[model samples]
Target chain A: MKLSELGEFGLIEIIQSIAEKSQNPRYDSWRRLLVGIGDDTAAWQAGDYIELATTDTLVQGVHFNLNVISWKELGWKALAVNLSDIAAMGGIPVYALLSLALPQDLEVENVTDFCHGLAELANQFEVAIIGGNLASSPDVVITITIIGFSKSNRILKRSTAVPGEQIAVTGFLGLSSAGLKMLQKKTTLDNETTNILRQAHLRPTPRIKEGQLLLQRGVNTAIDISDGLIADLDHICQASKVNAQIKIDRVPVHPLVKVYSLNQGVCRGQLNIIAGLPGSGVIANAD
Target chain B: MKLSELGEFGLIEIIQSIAEKSQNPRYDSWRRLLVGIGDDTAAWQAGDYIELATTDTLVQGVHFNLNVISWKELGWKALAVNLSDIAAMGGIPVYALLSLALPQDLEVENVTDFCHGLAELANQFEVAIIGGNLASSPDVVITITIIGFSKSNRILKRSTAVPGEQIAVTGFLGLSSAGLKMLQKKTTLDNETTNILRQAHLRPTPRIKEGQLLLQRGVNTAIDISDGLIADLDHICQASKVNAQIKIDRVPVHPLVKVYSLNQGVCRGQLNIIAGLPGSGVIANAD
Candidate 1:
C-alpha cells in the first residue's frame, strides 16, 4: 500500500506499535518514562523534574521555498516549531541538536546565516546549541531535536482534556495562512499589514510563558496549532477521547488576516483555519 | 564560499563559534554542561548521572543506496550509527527520537520494515522510542537523536588521549569497507565469506558493552571507526593536539578482508583504511 493511502497518523500508529512492543518491564528507562511516542514531547522523570524531548524536521521544497523565505527565517521557523511543541507540553527548552543535510554546492554564508537565526532565538530562550550532525544531500533538510524540562506535576498533555472543559486560545490564528496566501498571490496591501502578515507566517513566537502560565493556573490540556484548528482539535479529541465543538464566531482571527480575507472575498466572523502552516496558534483547556 | 569549500569541519567550527557565543554564564544549563559541540555527544549533568545526547542523519543516495541495502537494514544502520556515538562516550543509550522525511509514493511496507529494524535494535539496547517527527519529502532521510547516561566520572572523551598511550581496537577494521566494495562490485565469493563481509557492512554492531568495560577499566579516551582508521585517528589527534603513528603491520584486518584484499592485489601487511563507512572499529586508550 502507498503511504498516501495509509496517511500520516496511520504511519505513526505503525511506528508506535513497534515502539510499544519494545517496552520491556525489565528496562529501568521504561519505568521513568512518563510519556512516549504520541505526545508533543516524550517526557521522562529526571530527579525532581520531567525531561521533555521533541524532534522536528523541515525538508526543502516541501516545507519551505528558499525564494519565499530567507535562510535565517527558515532557521528561525525550524527551531520555533520545536519550541512550540515544548511549550505545548508546558516545558522550558534547554538544549538542541541540529542535523542538517545540505547540497554540496550551497553557500557557506547561507549556513552561517541559518546558525545566526537559530542562535538568536536560542539565546532568547536560554537554549544551548549542544551538538548535531552534518551530511550532504540533494536538497537542504534540517532536523532539530530539542530537550526541555518541566515540573513533574505541572506537565500539560493533549490526552487529558476533560469533557465540557472550556478551551482558550492564546494569540490570534489564521494570520500565517493568510500571509502565505498573500505571498503566493503577491497581494498588494498596506505596508504595516503586509509586514504583520508576512512576519506572522515567516517568524512565529512560541507561547512559552503563556504555556507555563496555563500550567500554573491548573490547565492540563494544550496543543500547538501547527496543523490548523480542525486538525489540531482532532488530535486532542482523538487522544483525549472526547468530542469538541468550536464556535466559529468565538475563534479569534487576526485583524491583518481579516483585512487580507476581505480583499480575497471572505466574510467576517468566519473561522479561518490555516490548515498546514505553523502559525501563532496556541490553545489550552481550563476546567 | 560553498559548503564543499568550507568543508564539514569548517562548517562545524562556524556553528560551534555561534554556539559558544550564545553560552551565557548566567544560564544554569551551561554550568551543568560538561561537553558540547566537537565531541561524539553533548553531555550535561542530570542529578547524579551525566546525560549524553547525539544526533546523526542518513540521506538517501548520499549515505545509502536503496539498490544496495534493504529498508530494514537502513533502519538498523540509522540507529546503529547513533548508538556508536553514544557508545563512544561510554554511555548507555536510554531513549531515542527519530525524524524521517520520506517520499510520498513510498510503500507502507518499507516504513514498517524500517521501524521493525529500528525497534529490533532499540529493544536490544533497551532504548525507548520516545518521540520523533515525520514529513513527506522526495527522498528518504532518517535522522535519529539518541540520549544516553553515564556516571560523571566514567565519561570517555576523544580529546583526552595522552601522548604515548597505546591505542587498542575492540574489533577488526576494514571489514565493512571490504563488504561494501564486494557489494558494489558484485564480487562473487564463497557464500560464507560473502555473508560475513556483507553483514559487517550492513549490520555493524555498536560496542556498547565494550565501551562501558573500557570506562570501567579507567580508559578515558575512545572513538568509533565510522570514517575508517585514518580519518577517525585524525579526529583524536586533532582533538587531543597529538600526532599518531600506526604500524601498518599491527593494524588488524579481518581474514575476509585479507582474502578480498589479496584478490585485489594488496599486500598482507598493508593498512586497509576504509574511509567513509560505518564499521566495527572501536579504539580506546588506556594509561
Candidate 2:
C-alpha cells in the first residue's frame, strides 16, 4: 500500500500504534515521559518544571510556493507551526533547533532573509534559536523542534472536555483560507484588503499568549487550529471520547472571508479557518 | 553568493553569527542557556542536571542512496548521528523527535521498514521515540532531534583542552569512509570483509558509554569524528587556541580499509578516517 492511500493522519496513527506497542521498558522506567506521541508536544519531567517538545516540517512544494510567499514569511511560518504546538500545551517556549535541507543553487541572500523572518518571530516569542543542522538536497526542507517548560501541573489537553460544555472560539476564523484562495486565484483587490488577506495567509500568528491566558483562566482542554477548525475540533472530540454539536451560525467567519467566498463562487461554510479554534471557549453545563 | 559556494560549515557559521547577534534579551535573562551553537549540542540548566539538545538532517541524494543502503540502515544512521552529538556532550539521551519529508509515491512498507530500524536503535540506546512530523515532498528527508541530560557539572568541550595535552580517539577510524568507497565502487570482497565494512557504514555506533566513562575519568575535552579525523581535530585545536602535531602512523585503521585502498589504487594516507581520533589516550607532556 502507498502512504497516499492512508493519508497523513492515518499514517501517524499507525506510527503511534507501533511506538506504543514496542516501547522499551528501560526507557519507560528511566525517562519519566509525561506525554508521548498523541499530544501536541511530547513532555517529560525535568526537575521542578515539566519539559515540552514538539517538531514540525515544511516542504517547499507541499507546504508553500516560493513564488507566492516571501522567504521571510516562509521562515516565520516554519517556526510558527512548531510554536503553535508548544502553545497548545500551555508552555513557555525556551529553545529551538532548526534543520534545513536546501538546494545547492539557493541564494545566500534568500537564506539570510529566511533567518531574518525566523529571528523576527523568535524575538516576539523570546525563543532562543540555539542550534540546527544544514544539508544539501534536491529541494528545500525546513524542520524545527521547539523545547518549552510549564510550571503549572495542569496542562491543557485535547482529551479533557465534556460533551455538555458549550463550545466557543477566541477570534475570527476562515480568513487564512480565504487569503489562500485569493492568492491561488490571483484576485486583484484594494491594497488594504489584499494586504490583510496576504498577511493572514503568509504570516499567521501563533496564539501563545492566548493559550497561556486560557490555562490561567482554568480552561483544561484546548488545541491550536492548524488543520482546519472542524478537523482539529474532531481531534479534540475523538481524544476526549465525546461528540460535539457545532452550530454553524455560531461559527465566527471574517467578513472578508464571505467576500472571498462570494467572489470565488463557493459557500462560506466550505472554507476552513487555519487558526483560531472552531469553538475555543467552553461553558460548563448546570447539570 | 550561492549557498553552494559557502558550503555547509560556512553557512552554519553565518547562521550562528546572525542568531548570536539577534538574540532576545528576555530569553537571555529568563532561560539560562549554557551552550548555544558551534558545539555538538546546545545545553541549558535544568535543576540538578543540565539539559542538552541537537538536531541533524539526512537528505536522500546528499547523505545516502537507497540503492546502496537499506531503509533500516538509513533509519539507524539517522538516530546514530544525533546520539553521537549527545555522547560528545557527555549526556544521557532521553527523548527524540523525528521529522520526515518523503515523496508522495513512497511505499507504506518502506516507511514501516524505516520505523522498524529507528525503533531498533532507539530500543538499543533506551531513548524514547517520542513524537515527530511527516510531510510529502519531492525527495526523502529525515531530521532527528535528540534531548539529553548530564548529571555531572563538567562537560567535555572542544575549547577546554590545554596545549600540552595529547589528543586521543576511542576506536578504529576510516572504516566508514572505506565502506562508503566500497559501496560506491560496488566492489565485491570476501563475505566477512564486506559485512564488516557494510556494518561500519550502515550502523556506526555512538560512543555514549565511552563518553560517560571519559567524563568520570576527568577528561575535560573531546569531540566525535563525524567529519573526518583531521577536520574534527582541527576544530578542537582551533577552539582551544592551540596547535596539534598528529603522527599519521598512530591513527587506527581497519585492515580491510588498507586492502580496499590498495585495490582502488589509492594511498592509505589519502583515505580519511571517518571515526576514531588521532591519539585517543591522554599523554601528559613533561615540560
Candidate 3:
C-alpha cells in the first residue's frame, strides 16, 4: 500500500507498534525509560533528572517550497517544531543534533544562512547545537533531535485531562494555516496583513516558558497544537478516554486571518485558528 | 562558493565554529556539557552521570544505492554508524531517535523490512527506539540520533595520544572499501570472499565492548575510521599536536581484501587495514 493512503500518522503508528513489540525484555530492568513513543517527547530517567528527547524532519518540496520560504525560515521552523514537542512536556530544551542532506549544487552562502537562522533560534532557547552529520542528496532534508530536561517531577500529558475541564488556549490559532493559504494563493495582500501571516508561518514561537509555568501551576494535561486544534484535542480525548465539547465561538482567531478569510470569500467560522499553542488552561468540571 | 568545494569535513568545521561562537553564556553554568562538537560524540553531564549524544545521516545515491543494498542492510547500517560514535566515546548506547524522509512511491513492505532490520539491531544492543519523525521527500534519507551513557569519567579522546605510542587496531579494515568496489564493478567472486566482504559493508559491528575495555585498561586516545585510516589517524595526530609514523607492515589486512586487491592488480602493502576500531591501543611513550 502507498504511504499516502496510510498517511504520516498511520506510518508512525505502524513503526511505533514494531518498536514496542520488538523491545528487549532486558531493557525493562534498566529503569531509565520512563516513557517511550506515543507522546510529545520520549522521557527517560537519567541519574537525578529525567531527560526528554524528540526528533522532527523537514523536507524540500514536501514540508515547504524554497520559493515561498527562505532558507533562514526553513531552518528556524525545522528547529521550532521539535522545540514545541519538548515544550508540550514542560521540559527545557538543552542540546540539539542536526542532520542535513543537501544537494551537491547547494550554495555555501545559503547553507550558512540556514545555520545562522538555526543558531539564532538556538541562542534564544539556550540550546547548544553540539554535533550533526551532513551528506549529499538529491533534495534538501533537515532533521533535528532535541534533548531536554523537565523542571518538575510532574510532566503535562494529553492522557491526564479530566472530562469536565474547561479548555482554554493562550494564543490565537489558525493564523499559520491562513498564512499558508495566503502564500499558496500568491494574491496581492496588504503589506501589514502579509507580514503578519508570513511571520506567523515562518517564525513560530514554541511555548516553552508557558508550558513550564502551566506545569508549575499544577496543570497536568496539555499539548502543543501542531495539528489543527480539533485534531489535537481529539488526541487528548482519545488518550483520556473522554469526549470534549469545545465552544467554537470561544476559539481565538487572529484579526488578520479573519480579514484574509473574509477577503477570500470564506466564512470566519471555517478558519481553524486554534493551532500553535502558546499556553493552554484546563479547569476542573464540578459535575 | 558551493558546499562541494568545502567538502563534508570543512562544512562541519564551519558549523562547529558558528555553534561555539554563538553559545549562550547562560548555558555555560549548566555544568552538564562535559564535551561538545569536534569529537566522536557530544558528552554532557546528565544529573549524576555523563551522557553522550551523536547523529548520523545516510542519503540515497550518496551513502548507498538501492540496487546494491537491501532495505534491511540500509536500516542496520544506519543505526550501526550512530552506535559507532557512542562506542568511540566509550559509552553504552541506550536510545535512538530516527528521522526518515522517504519518497512517496516507496513500498510499504520496503519500509516494514527497514523497520524490522532497525528493530533487530536495537534489540541486540538493548537500545530502545523511542520516537522519530517521517516525511515524504524526493529521495530517501535516514538520520539516527543515538543517546548513550559513558562507562567512566575518562572518555577516550583523539587529542590525548602521545608521540611514539604504539598504535594498534582491534579489527582488520579495507574490507568494506573492497566490498564497495566489488559491488560497483559487479564482479563475481568466491562465495566465502563475497560473504566476508559484503558482511563487512552491510553489518559493521560497533566496538562498544572493546571501547569500554579500552577505557578500563587506561587507554585514552582513539578514533573510529569512518574516513580512511590515514584520514582518521590524521585527526588524532592533529588533535594531539603530534605526527604519526604508521608502520604499514604492522597493519592487519583482511585475507579477503588482500585477495581482492591482488586480483585487481593492486599491492597488498597499500591496504590500510586499521580503519574500523573496536579497540585501538595507544600507550604512553616511554621515550
Candidate 4:
C-alpha cells in the first residue's frame, strides 16, 4: 500500500483513472479537448491553434542537490524541463507559472538568481512568466506549469506514429546521466568533458526548433528524453501501439559519457539505455 | 537578506521586477498578453476568448496539518484554492495540472483519497485534470495550475475597479479561520456549531457561479478573499490606485464564527478583519 510499492507511474495511473471518471460528460470544454492525462502534454483546441499544458516539480534533495547544482542552474533546469515537454509536442511555449516553496532562512539572492536564470531562458524563447505562488516550507520546492500552442495542423502526438516509421534522436545521449554520475561521485575528468556533461545535466537546451522542424517534415510522433531513452521510447510504443527494434550499436552515445563510463568502470550502454537516468535529447519518429 | 527578512511581498517584488525586465517586447505572445504578474491571474487573448492562468501551492504544516485535515479535504482544498483564483478573474476554469511531491512511505489510499476529493470538486466545475508531475519528497507538497477563459468583454481584473465603485463581499467572512482555530485548539463547541465551523474550514465552496454572475452584472473588479478581507482589499486598492473605507460593523461575519469567537473570549472583529486568515468569500467592486 506504500507509495514505494505503487511507484510514480502506479500513482499516476490511479490519479488518471479518477480524473477520467470524474469528468462531467455535459461540460462544454470536453468538445475542445484533443488529448488529456497520458502524454507529454495535455492538448486542446483554441480556435486556430492547439494549446498545450504541462507541469513539472523539483524537490530540493530528490531532484537536485544545492552542492552539485548552482541556484541559477536550478532555475534554468526547472524551466527547461517544462519547455522540453512543449517541444516534444512541437509547440511553442508562450507562458509559464512558477510556484515556489522556500525555507524562510534561505537568502534572497538564491531566489533572485533563480529568477534571473529562468528569465534569461524565458527571454530566449520569448516565453513569459505570468503568475505564480510563493509559500514557506522546510525544503526548497519549485513547480512550473508551462502553457504553449501550436498550429492545429502541425502539432505532434506520440499516438500518431505509424508501425513502419523510423526512430531517431535529435542529439547525443547519456551525457546527462554520465555528468550526473560524475557530479555525484566527484569523478574528475578533463575540464572540457566535465563542462560538457555538467552543462548537459544542469543547463539542457530544449529542442524547440528541432521539434518544429520535425513536425514540418511530417514527423507526427516525438517525446523528450527526460526519462532516459528506452523509457521514453516505450511511451511512444505504448501510445502508438507499435514495437521498436533497436540496434544497440547504432544508439548515439556522447563521447564524454563514454569517457566517463570507461574511467568509472561502468558500461556506457547502462548510462545510455537505462530508465530513470534523464537527458534532454528529443526522440523523434519519422517516416 | 533572508527570505523572512524580505517577506513574501518583498520577494514577489524582486521576482516581478525580474519578470518585467526579462520579457522580450518582440515576442508574438506579448502582443496577445493582456495582463501578466502582479494580478490574481495572468491573462492573454486566445482568439475570441481571453485565457486566464493561475497557480497556487499548499505545503503541509504551513498550509494544513494532516492530523486536522483529511486527505480528501486536502485534495478538495488544493484544487478549490486554484479555482478561487480563476473565479476571482470571472473566468470559467476548464483544466488543471496538479504537481504533487509526497513521501515515499505514504500509503496509496492517501493519494487516491486526495485525488477523489480533488476530482469531486473538479467534476462540480467540469474542469479536467489534464496533466501533471509527481515526485518524492519528505513533505507533502501540492501545487495546482488552473487554466480558464472568458469572453474578452466579460473578464475581470483587480486593477479595473473605479473610485466610485462600492466594495462588497459575496458571503460571510472569518468562518474558515475560525474553524481552523476550533480544530487547532480542540475547542469544545455544540455539535451543530462544531460541524458548521469545521466544514467551513474543510470544505469551503468556491464562488464560481457568483463570480460569473458578477461579471454578467458588469462588475469588472474582484478578488477572492483567500488572504483575508483587508489584505485583499489592499490588493484591489493598490492595483486600481484607489482607496477603500470599510465599515467594520457592516463586514459580514458567520454566526458560527461569532459564537466560537465569543466562546473563546476572542474579539469577533479580530478574526473578521485580520490580514492572514483565509476565506472563500469573493470581494467585488461594483458601481
Identify the candidate with maximal DockQ: 1
Native-to-model Cα distance after best TM-score fit, residue B174 in candidate 2, in Å: 0.9
lDDT of each: 0.83, 0.79, 0.78, 0.83
Give the 10-residue window scoring lowest on summed lDDT in candidate 2 chain A.
Answer: A278-287
DockQ, model 2, C-alpha based: 0.65
In terms of lDDT, the poorest run of 10 residues in model 1 chain B is B278-287
In terms of lDDT, the poorest run of 10 residues in model 3 chain B is B278-287
Q: Please write out the lDDT profile of model 3 over residues B62-180, one tens digit for every residue.
A: 89899999999888888888888887777889998888888777887789889988988888888899888888888888999998987577788787888667786768768778877
Choose 3 or 4, whichever is better by lDDT.
4
| Candidate 2 lDDT by residue in tens digits, A1-287 | 88888798888887777666657555642358878887788888776778899999999888899889999998898988888888887888889888888988999989988988998888888888899998888888999999988868667777788856767665778777777778877989889889888888888788777777778988888777677677778788778887777767766778888777777786665566433333333421100
Worst 10 residues of 3 chain A by lDDT: A278-287
Positional deviation of residue B105's Cα in model 1 after best superposition, in angstroms: 0.5
Off by over 4 Å in 4: A274-287, B274-287
In the range B1-287, model 4's lDDT, one tens digit per residue, is 99999999999899989998866668876778888988888999887789999999999999999999999999998988888888888889999999999999999999999999999999899998888999999999999999999864467787877766777787888888888888988988889888888888888788888888888887788887777788887787787777766666677777777767777987765565544322222384210
Ranking by DockQ: 1, 4, 2, 3
Which scores better on TM-score, 1 or 3? 1
Classified by CAPRI criteria, candidate 1 counts as high
lDDT of model 3 at position A117: 86
**Candidate 3, lDDT over the whole model:** 0.78
Candidate 4: C-alpha RMSD after superposition: 3.5
- Model 1 misplacement above 4 A: A266-287, B266-287
Fnat measured on candidate 1: 0.90
> What is the lDDT, from 0 to 100, of the residue A272 in candidate 3?
54
How are the candidates ranked when ordered by lDDT, highest leading? 4, 1, 2, 3
TM-score of each: 0.94, 0.94, 0.93, 0.95
